[model samples]
Target: MGAQGCREDGRPETVLEGWFVLLLDLEAFAPRERVDAFHHAMTDSSVPNEIVHEECDAGMSARIEGWRVGALDLFDMRCSGLEVRRTARHVRQHRDRPVVSVSLQTQGIHRAEQAGTRSTLGPEDICVFHELAPRTYGWSGHGASQAVTVDMEHLGLPVDTVVRASGRLRASPVHDLLLGHLRSLFRDPGRLEADPGAGALANATTDLVRALLTSAAHDERDGRVREAMGSSLVPRIMAYARRHLTDPDLGPERIAAEHAVSKRQLYVVLGRAGIRLEQWLIGERLEAACRLLVSPHHAALPVSAVAARCGFSSPSHFTRRFRAAYGTTPSEWRRHRIRSIC
Candidate 1:
């Protein structure tokens, strides 16, 4: 939420957490038609699975809404008595992006089976499972859950650490914190996603999940977890800075303030990662300007406009730096790129 307000470049506000794109209301479908439609939606949704429930009763219904938040996908799901299976076959058939699924049970009973372990979760209970592994999950009656799927690599933990933590999340001190966050997120998904700082919020959520896993696995002795935890700040800072690159005032003081660090501390973190803060910022700004110069949509804009959009306040200064970096002026670079494409 510390991110800058509205952009001045006139681009539409960036929606960090994308709008929910998958919406299904199966209650209106005929009893016989509901299962197939639900099955199709299940297969097509962000997480692919095989719908195995055999009954097609009149009361059966399912509604799922999914939102994308950076490296995470969140689903608000409600259904009446159904099972979904994700076998090794399903794993192979779908895209091979390994992820971990965290589910917060809010209504009815949710049953999950994975790695020879079966768990029955009631309201306010949480469960975690690896998406690439063979698993079966569903409920026997009407149930609702808020599920978040995050790319495994983003956790910065080894596979064994995650596997160990998955079945024992409550052992972690931060489990309730993560649970409460998911609850609040799903309460008004659209409104929250629309917030300007939703991207940073999502990143914070991912960090909390990582911390929870590290604590649950009792991985303080494990150097991988310890090192990952220690070294995460650099990436976090870089991401924050990149998001604000369009702001001319995105300097050390502003960045340090947003991250709750002193300007000196910010420099120390990036310095440890071999980054020269001023040069890095300039490089990123130049790179952004280069992309805009060659982009078809921005081609009509003058070189000065392109420089201004990328945070440069002086057109002549932008040209000099652009030429120094790319061996040509911005206008020349854009013309060359257009000619090459044609």
Candidate 2:
């Protein structure tokens, strides 16, 4: 519960961690409905996976705590022993984009493998892996792990660079720097969700990852790293967009001006990430609204206020979009989770 309370001056009133999204908890599902519930919760709430639990009848439990740092998806997950995999078939069937993960084992034993490389990552040890390539997350006993996921294309490193670094333990000082921020950030992701400086914190988080990976896998002889970093435009746009998500003027034109680019350039950059600008904006706003609906800090606010807080100019429009995205109106969704929120 390190995630709430702020001064009227809009500064942290206590050492409380920032608020976060509670993705899922197995205990919330009925025992008879747990399997499909977990599967859907994991696949739809986070990444898609083919899971093999140790015992179906056993009370397998998990809680997925997560937040977004711009384009990166940060997750802190604890669970009973299980084997999880993402393979070519799963990727093809879902049309999964090429996403990658940088993770640390927070508890118990964890083994991971991808692209013919394998590593046994322990607490404070870091490892990297990706979708569209075979990867496995397994443990013989209950454990937890925290990860930051970003698309391979958005990483600003050559695919070969990430491919080579996959399943390898990073022991350098750079690894230490990466893990330090990750641990600190995960401890209070709520800050990034509610603080006015959320955008800065999120960008700093992404920058640390980019630096660690670039230094770890970069080959100075090819001059590709510089080229890649210069050409990576999506992160910049996302940083601007995430910061101003609640701004009524937030849109392609304003964002483009903020980044010193044309509206066309903005679209081109987002297009490279394979998501239209408007679609991405709506999706992010809906996600923000959904988070506020269930979060304690914002729970006292009216649903209309939450929509405005997330930048929707019209409460009715926000309601329609929220229902479409989550299959329930904002009020119903909030009421549905009253027990958990309280």
Candidate 3:
């Protein structure tokens, strides 16, 4: 089945199933004015908007804020008469940042132009645009359209490769995958945040987006997809380390035993990622200590108390490491951070 025909309720399956979660928090902005304010805020932050009201449909029957959280930000937007004019003023607005925004039309029709390429997207059709460059968008018709927007920052993967791999138009496989992922995210907004598989699903979505964007930017294909999958073990290892950071015996030996792997193998895996087991443990300890230091509940606690909670046996050692990592003693950093916040 084509990507467009796939439903979010899992009626027809697609290859890019576990891509994103759709989070719709209407209660977050209850008042109509608050919703209008949010809409204006979004337009100011990213695009310029001129919303016109029509009797055919209220400007927006439902106000939605769609968030696609992977390593990057994938935004799903459903709204009415959402028109954007990307003029020289817009480019000057963003400076020289390389930003890419991809939108898949789930319901209305959209006309978009970028880099002299113009595309009209019907339902299930997708469009890609660079934020730093000049572009314009217009949507018309009776129904609202749902679009997925990916920011350039979250796409840690290359861009040229993604474009090439997905094609430049309506008949591209990469485009299909992106459209399918967006559909899934929209169909199941609750699963992204509440599901146990959300983390893995988010990571995979990031990889796929990175791959697609990289292919788009470059005409070449790299092994980023494979590498992202292979390095997926890092999250599990990090989780284990974080959970056991306070344990004195939470060293390489314990980690290996817990994972049913040899100490050397554990080291090898971490080493491949350019991290030493001891250093990684120390980093975790320092992070934990930092958190405790800044926490208001622990503000009255002594430095030693904070250090012990974070698995530092000797206050002096903890102080030394903390200073080395943060360029200040724990107490000083904590005091400064809290005071600044206040």
Best by lDDT: 1
- Residue 251 displacement in candidate 2 (angstroms): 41
Highest-TM-score candidate: 1
Model 1 per-residue lDDT tens digits across residues 311-340: 887899899988889999888888998999
lDDT at residue 251 of model 2 (Cα atoms): 86
lDDT of 3 by residue, 191-286 (tens): 455567565666655555554454445433346534543454454465556666887667888878865678888888888767788997899688
For model 2 the local lDDT of residue 50 reads 86
Clashes of each: 0, 5, 22
Residue pairs with backbone overlap in model 2: 2-17, 3-17, 18-190, 18-191, 19-190
The estimated TM-scores of all candidates read 0.59, 0.57, 0.46
Superior candidate under lDDT, 2 versus 3: 2
Each model's RMSD to truth, in Å?
A: 13.8, 15.2, 15.7
Instruction: Provide the lowest-lDDT 10-residue window in model 3.
Output: 1-10
Q: What ranges in model 1 sit over 4 Å off?
A: 1-19, 54-58, 224-342
Flag the better candidate by lDDT, 1 or 2: 1
Estimate, for each residue in 44-67, the C-alpha lDDT of model 2 and write its tens digit. Answer: 654667899876345787777777
